[model samples]
Target: MGMAMTSSPQPPPPPRRRRSRLQSATTISAPSANPKPNPKAKVIPLLSDVGRLQSATPTPTPNGNPSPNPKGKVLPLLSDVGSNPSAIDYYSRVASNLAGAGRLGDFLIAAEGLRAASGDAGFAARINWRLLSRGVVAALREHGLPHVLEFLRDADRIGVHATVMLDADASDAVAAACRQLLDERIMAEFVEAIEALARFFVKGIVDPMDVLKIFVRKRDPDMAIRYARIFPHSQLLLCNTMEAFGKRKELKHALKVFGALKDQLGGINMFACRSIIDICSHCGSSVQARIIFEGLLAEKITPNTHVFNSLMNANAHSMSYNFSVYKHMQEIWCPS
Candidate 1:
């Protein structure tokens, strides 16, 4: 009976684990055929690891407070940047590294993180905002104008100085906006674009005069006034925008601009009076020209010889009116 049991093939010896002289408590074993993931393994996320961040549920701390990160350093939620210096550097470096790696999408994530991190505290002042802006502008060049506009809004929300973006590429941004308008002819898009450019003007990146010209060329006096009003100190801009309409033979637009300016307490200077008179002369509205001259007197605006000449030209079709203008000139400007 004992020999039969021995011949029955002793149950396969329990799998042997060969020992090595080098083996120690710290020694790592080769992965099994189906090794389970290590729960304690450390995972260092890249700066651009947006998914991991967004999906990370706040872990409870020893004090029962939920923390965004484990090291007792609480990070702000996405889109809400806080003042953590290390967090700022983490995002900025990730952006730069991804940019250098030619990973545009990842770079974008890092850029957003950097911008968000800059919003709450003085972090914006500490980092190179210009460099961050440049990276975004470069990466989105292939994208559309809507994306550009969205970026501007994001920057604004993040407390980035408007000047920071303007300095990055003012002319290029303007040209891109204009090019989009030319392609689509969407007035809404054009308005949005002008709004963006107006930010540049407010920051002093673009000349206000150029902006005025752009609005006047669109022939929408209302839109022109709307934007011009954004700059409370744009009296000269209003007058010049009004005068430009005269050259376009848009008498009504000029009149509207003049009325809006007057309503805003924009002192009607001699330049504005002359511009309106010229417009009346072009449109052959001698009656309107006469009304403006009288109003100038009421406002105590000094009328010069140049005004009399323009008044006379305005009344070219009316001999009596022309004689009256001459008499006025003699009484005020050319008494000799």
Candidate 2:
């Protein structure tokens, strides 16, 4: 028991550790196996990194108000573009070509930078018939009519100007295209355009009947006549053509177009009414002309002095004119 007690006491508080210099050096030199991750770790997200993410991360809504990014910095906008040689070089070439060609629209489309640069909406609405015509004429002078025609085929109004611009030799193509449109039922869109083109082809203002003749020969007569009425200045052309047809004894065609013209004009013109009379007289359909004259008298459009003179002249030849036109004219006249 005495020995045990002495041995236990001999262990005495193992000398209060004064860290050995070697131990301290070892601790300082050795790397720890269970090291802690850095607080400023790359695992933390950046604002740009957050922005670049799509659909994976939920956007923050803190109390319905999101926290702002902690690491954001403003970046300069397009600062490097000025120094980009390729971009500048490309634009320089395009600009020179545009200037030489007087094609500012094309130049802008091909420029270094622009949004909404290409397509019909960008350039189509900006042009008018006259300016477009001048440009087309220049292109034809430089290139040829075929190229201009090809360009116009894309837009109906442009097609019209092209029609006028094309030489008569190209009429086969123009008429063929127009006929194709008629077949496809798209001619309504192209009708006025075609008429304008026809006027250009015929030189000077085209008679409405002439346009009708072109339209009717290829498409429906009623459809052509209807479209002719819509054209500005078509009335005089229709009226004159009707008169000329009557003189040439082309009775059936004259009467057919005349009736259509009458309806289009609301059947109210004294000029149209007189043409009917003359057509009937020459075709021996004076009876029909007489019927129309009586209807006009009933409508209170009394024969004018000039109309009466023509009536008197007609009557001098035979009772046919006298029995019809003169009788109608004399009834409306207050004897001088």
lDDT of each residue in 1-336, candidate 2, tens digit only: 465544334555766878999989987877778899775653322222423534233357868765566554332212222554343333334433442463533533333231122212323322333444445445555764445444555334322233443444444444555555545656564564464454444233333465555554453545555565665666776666566666666666677767777777775776776676777677766556556666767887786665555544434556665667655565556465
Clashing pairs in 1: none
Q: Give a tens-digit lDDT track for model 1, residues 227-267.
A: 67767566777888888998888889999998888888756
After superposition, candidate 1 runs with Cα above 4 Å error? 1-31, 34-42, 45-88, 91-122, 125-143, 162-174, 201-219, 226-244, 261-265, 316-336
Query: For model 2, what is the alpha-carbon lDDT of residue 98?
Result: 47
Best by TM-score: 1
User: Which one is best on lDDT?
Assistant: 1
Clashing pairs in 2: none
Candidate 1 achieves a global lDDT of: 0.66
Worst 10 residues of 2 by lDDT: 112-121
